[model samples]
Target: MDVFPLPLARIGIIGGGQLGRMMAKAAKRLGCTCVVLDPTPGSPASQVAGHQILGDYHDPSKLRELAEICDVITFDIEDIDTETLAQLEQEGHRFHPSPRVLALIQDKLTQKQAFAAAGIPTAPFVELSEPSPEAFAAFGYPLVQKARRGGYDGRGVSIVKTPEDYDAHLPVPSLLERFVPAAKELAVVVARARDGECRCYPVVEMCFRSGENVLDLLLAPANIPSSVAEAAVDLAVRTVEMLDGVGIFGVELFLTETGELLVNEVAPRTHNSGHHTIEANVTDQFEQHLRAVVGLPLGVTDQLSPAAMINLLGAPGRRGRPIIKGMAEALAIPGVCLHLYGKATSAPFRKMGHVTVLDPDIETAKRKAERVRDLIEISAEDHP
Candidate 1:
């Protein structure tokens, strides 16, 4: 096997969220610098990055400055204006996963169609300019209406169970999708290099709370039939091939009651489900993403142990700086790792941090994970 040299001294990240913060930390470990561009002065990534560029995504001058300073650019969020990025790319800026890939995945309608065109199976869906009663009738009731652009973490997504429910929330441009009756939700994280080399991590089974997926409890190396796991990985690889996707691609899937797997969605970067890989895999997703984007050799995706991840969300009816009421109790659990994103304010349904637990057996890991999750509680109160 031929070894590839690392890129330049510094890499630029377009978002200053927790994902970017973690990526910056990984880069620093490799003796590389990470420069983050975000409008917020106190953004999570900015706190850890070697340098920070405070500007809006639409500011071309700032983009050009970032392009001049860093070897390659990648994004932690897809909400950035791709048109501007495309212009920068033409002017000698190099972007990972490419602006074209970001453009396609930013819009839910285009993303779903891309899956079908790639010969990937996904739930039936129809695009809508206005989610009216008649439009809802076409897709049938108990369907999901999601904004084509700028939706994440259960926001801008709603279920229309009946005609009355549809009438209540009208005048929104969204996509109506058939809600697949799923037995389990699974996800696979795949990383692909610019040279087309790719590797997939072990599959993860996900559980949602209260019809909203804000809180995730992930079971790694999902205890599914071997055939099912293989199929999931195959689908993920195919999707990456179709997009010519670079860096980490997270393929969210639905395992139906009929033993069929359907692609739910694709996130073009590191994802929350892959968070367990940080402790359980030979190489974590952040490093893999860096390697892929910089044209380096991909890392091993083999699992070292069974793991589970629980997301901590802020409790409702409370406001201000967040506090984990039972942090010491949760941290006391053996083999439990907690990661808190440094955010000053907390609101209902906001993702504050995550907890990961590992064990030799999947069930035991899940039990320990639940215990840790139960012990910790996030309240929107000022923490002295």
Candidate 2:
């Protein structure tokens, strides 16, 4: 293999959330500078990035400004105005995964349609031109309604298990999917270089928060049959390869009780599920994404240790400057790595940060992760 020289690059990130913050940090390690664009002046990514361009994701002028100053651009969000990005790309600006892919993935229904057209295995779904209780009943009970666009962190999804649940259905263009009684939720982060070289991280199992539908805990190298793990990875790799996208892709999968694996969704950027990779993998997803976008060789995706990670969400009823407690106690535990996002305020269940526990044994790692999860509390400083 010819030695690929690292280029001194300026990477522009579209969203200034925790994902972008971590991606900016990884770029810094590669001797690259990052400028983040977000509406919030002091957004989480802006706290650590070289600079931030304060603007909305859909602002065409701001997008152009970001493109002019940076060698390549990527997004931590899926809701950006892809039309502006597509125009920028035509004007010689580079975007990882391309604006076309983002446009498709931004609309949940369109994404599913493409997947189905490509012969991908996914849960049965239908586009709801008119999502009425009658229509929902016709489709059958126990359905998952996902907004076609701009849904994230469990905000734009609703579960209509029966006629009574129709009152809670999302009042927007959406798709109704048959709720799979999944035995487990798994994710694989795949990194694809500009030249089509691809690598997949070990399969990680996801456990969502009750009622919130947000990722709560994750276990790396998901405890499952070796054959199942292999099948999961294969499906994930194939999914990314099919997209033909550069940069890291997170493929969320549903493992049915009958031994079938289905693709739940795909994120075109580095994802929350791969957070433990920062401590356990030979190459973290953020750095891998940077390498792919900057035309460098994709890094090794080997897991160096079994790991578990838990999200630290804001306490339910606290909404002010975040007051994190038990950091000292949590840090004292062996193999505990904590990351706090610099958000100015906390809201109920808002993603504040995360903790990753690494141990020789997955079970031990999970126990330590849960212990850390309980030890830490994120509340408002003003809370009485």
Q: What digit string (tens of lDDT, one per residue) describes model 1 on residues 15-81?
A: 8888998898878776668889998888888888858999987688887788898989998998888
Q: What tens digits encode model 2's per-residue C-alpha lDDT throughout 1-384?
A: 555345479999999999999999999899889999999989999898959999999999999999999999999999898999999999999999899988888999988998898888999999987778788988998999999988998989998888987899988999999999999999999898998888999899999997999999999989999999999988888888878888999999999999899999999999999999999999999999999999877889899999999999999988998999999999999999999999989999999999999999999999999999999999997744
Point out where model 2 deviates above 4 Å.
1-7, 382-384
Predicted structure with the largest TM-score when compared to the true one: 2
lDDT of 1: 0.87
Misplaced by over 4 Å in model 1 are 1-8, 167-170, 382-384
Top candidate, metric lDDT: 2
Q: After superposition, how far is residue 306 of candidate 1 from its true place, in Å?
A: 0.3
